[model samples]
Target: MTGVQKLENSKRNKIQAYDLAIHDWYQFILGYPPHLVRHYIEKFGVSKYDIVFDPFCGTGTTPVEALKNGISSYGLEANPIATFASKVKTYTDYDPDLLLEYLAYIRRSMESSYSNYGIVEPQADLFSYKARFCTIKVKDIINLTESQLQVIPKGFISPKPLLKVLIIKEIIRSIENKDARDFFLLALAKFIVKEAGNVRFGPEVGRTKPKSDIESIHSFTTIAEIMINDVQKTKLTGQAQIMQGDARSLDKYMTRELVRGINCVITSPPYPNEKDYTRSTRLESVLLDFIRNKRELRGIKENLLRSNSRNVFVSDNDSRYISSFSSITSIAQEVENRRLALNKTSGFERHYNKIILHYFGGLYRHLKTLRPYLARNCKLAYVVGDQMSFFRVLIPTAELLGEIAESLGYRIKEIELWRTRAATATKMQINENVLILEKK
Candidate 1:
């Protein structure tokens, strides 16, 4: 298909009935659809016996899709909550019937316990509860550490739902089976994000509405049931391994045994936008003890690919990797020039140019790390988008990354347009394309 045709096809087939299996568990609002991953997997000629790798596997779309197709795959994600979600979503060893039975036991125990505490069961239609703040007094509910409480924004989760969630968390933790505990916690995480929290993703994480008291028990049970049903339907023979580590340094996670086996890579790395990837999972991450303090939050941000100005620090030297690439340098300079012309003097505005440099540099470092792992004929596909976030200075991200890959001894096979999104700042259409490459 032509590039435009391919883009149209991708948009048309973004979601299908078949995609609702394992991918619907916990997904980002702007996560690329399962069909896109499958398209690249098929295009790369990856077979069941071959191994595929996703260096920036956000929510395990690529790896889960790979396993569904009977192909073994490996994934790397920097965010702990995302990593946990990816690992749990792809895990198929949980017996669906046993999971349901466990859910029943937990529900009964929780209900009985809450009854003794004089807490009524959440009504089925309790989703419409719009109390200003949870007036229901909760006593002896599991409490977050002062540090953990500080991580969550004020009013993110109100008293009643928070109490219920804490109770569920405590109950889930007491489960002896590691898999069952993870499954239950994962379900709870989904509940927190989808129902309990007032957070919304307008393609960015923010609070759009007020939610005082959520139907916590009802929502959790409903989600757990859906997960149980999904687990029963998903039958797979291939393995999906997810590593919670930075993609910039694959050596820390990619083992020698996995290196020589990987023949294809399909991933969508972060683009040079001021989007804090960590914030998207902050609610679950902090609640689940992934990040409890400013120090821990900063530490997690440090491990991610530097795509935004928010995470840029004085110690970051990824820009050195692209010093010799005039294409990247030119973009950085252009962004700075635009900033100067626009008279933008904010600290973040000043670092827009630097963020562009660091973003590509991080990707370059990551690609360089992959060189030692990929086979001679390994095919790779990077789903990236153009950016005009920096004072309307357009960033040709896919083209520039393709050039960088070529410089790193990879041959550019094609740059196929996958889709387009309107830049919120520029009101211009930004191309989201797949940069196809092959190791020489």
Candidate 2:
């Protein structure tokens, strides 16, 4: 079979057991599968002597996959929570039995404390203002400060379950083993999104069925058990240099000497689909203290690539980077023209064109900055989806990004169709492409 045929077959088949190790610890809502990363790793000829870099490593899939193959890698993530998760998931050397023991101790302590405090499960009431107003005492549990509470959506987490989660977090914090504690937190973050929080993702951030109460300890322990099993089976080796910083300024985080050794890059950056990447991880981010206030949340959003109108700020000037590209400018103008003809003038609707420009511009800047870091003949695969979110104006993301890279003197190897998704408005299947490039 051809390499692409094998990759497509892997995606079609069921997820394998070996693929579910640390890679499944706490993934993004719509992250590419580990087999995809492995396909590119093999195709790029990565080895322990070479280095792979993922500039927008959300949840660390590339790093985990690279480390699993014993390849030295580097991952740069803008989100603090995601950066922490990637680092913990890639780092090894913890005994599975010890991790399980720590989980047992934490669960026991949390349950004992809950029993002592006489904390009962809150009733699920859809319209009980009284129940909502009722505050549970958390003197024995770790209570969130007013600022932290303000950042979380009111109905997403009920009071009783929130208290239990806080207690479990405190237990995780008390662990002396740094690696164990970090792994525990990553598991907790996953449990919070999957089981604890009332949020649901139809691949977008929205409320589904409200969860009034959850057995936080049970949920946390269940995920931890899965993690321990994965640890026991997987022998993690190789170095992963992780950083939390902006991708546009690649040189700031990766030194010139380090960049000269980078041989390959396999990453899936945010597409211009109008989906705010920040909102998908908002609940866990706030609960885990990665974002404590509006200011911090705003700061995090600012560092991200400007792909959505929600994150566009007055200070954004990334469009200047792509000002010379007539095709990008015309695309942005067409989006604005379409919006004006449709008479859609909501705040976000007005900036659809600007979002496209800035999205490509930010990507252009990253590519230009990245040019200095890539070694000669380094192969890079960027997985991006064609977007039609802005009023059915089809955005050929992969093609445009390839153009930007070519303009920077890189060789465009080929654009491969990775997958397809049906666009709701346009009723057309948009392709998610793998744009392969090689440094000259």
Candidate 3:
């Protein structure tokens, strides 16, 4: 491939090695890469004086990149765990010495906890035969409440790993410094999903072979040291503020000083599909106390863009915003028609049509809510993909989103193709495009 072609391919979704300092602390599996954000930041001539914003800031990829480039940015995320991560990753005022001190304290506390359970100093690999034979009383293990247990998918974590994680979590909580505690917690979150938890992401949250036990302390400290080193080497140039709120009503979270202040926007909102965005972070969310019960889970979903069958609620009226747009309504109708034709009668299958309408409608609401806050001629890039997840019906997400933005008085600049992926059901390639827009 030519150099330009190779560059485009690399920028599609892969995070470059040099960009891992803060971006890799914790991230969503489907989040757009930092290079993609840099592409738009440069394309729009975003500078230190300009403010960048990401409404659907999953794990702060845009905000973290913006800060790295010395551009002040703001991000709004509906998921609490993502909001927490964005705040932690973009924060630059941490003391490495203090972090190390906290780490030592945490290690000592963990070692003591292990000894109480009859595990000795220099804890062996929990998965080892002798280690596996080591036993702890059931009452000593930290257990989730029935409601918390119900929220996480069955088999997402085994008992031993969960016990070790909870032990570390308790030790981390005893630290007095909030930032230090959060820094440690973020590292633990990574260890949970990547090491301790039985979850795997093939782009969809699913189970892997269960890990009988894990060397939790070692794994957590290793992740923590990497994060601490990144903080030590990187200079925090730009400012970032991440808030947990629905994107559709951004005005609720905006400050008076930021009114009409945003010069550029870059983000990847959830696409209309069967994949529940919450499931990807369910283990962390519940484990971290961001979500505790069915009620709390519903509350988080209600604040997000209705992009999947799982979050489409009867009380939702986002579809009413696009009542006159036949192009979008037709797609929703077709999905429903396909569902009926195929005799798909499950509860989730029944909501396929609504997911399309609600998804686009939610974006429309977001763009409309964001207009008054954007500076004149502000450029926006939404990284979204086409999907055929529902009964083999295609949803041109970027195209339809552009149409919605236009009706809300934004000008459609261009729809740039980022990459294409095979549809899960049909295995046919589908485009993931960056829908560029400008405030008129």
What TM-score, computed on C-alpha atoms, does each candidate reach?
Answer: 0.93, 0.93, 0.94
Q: Model 2 over residues 289-322: C-alpha lDDT tens digits?
A: 8988989989999999999999999899999989
Give me the candidate number with maximum lDDT: 3
Q: Between 1 and 3, whose TM-score is larger?
A: 3
**CA RMSD, predictions in order:** 4.6, 5.7, 4.0
Which pairs of residues collide in model 3?
A: none
lDDT (Cα) of model 3: 0.86
Q: Model 2 — TM-score against the truth?
A: 0.93
Q: Which ten residues in a row have the lowest lDDT in candidate 2?
A: 124-133
The local distance difference test score of model 1 is 0.82
CA lDDT scores, all candidates in order: 0.82, 0.82, 0.86
TM value for model 3: 0.94
Tens-digit lDDT track of model 3 for 1-440: 32223576536577878889989999899898788888888888999999999999989999999988999899999999999999999887999998887877776666667766765434444332211112234455556899999999999999878887887787777778999989999998999999989999996889999988777667777899999999998887878888889999987899875795799999899888778899999998999888999999999999999988889898999999998999999988998999889999999999989988888888889999999999999999998999999898888888898988888899999998888888999999999999999999
TM-score of 1: 0.93
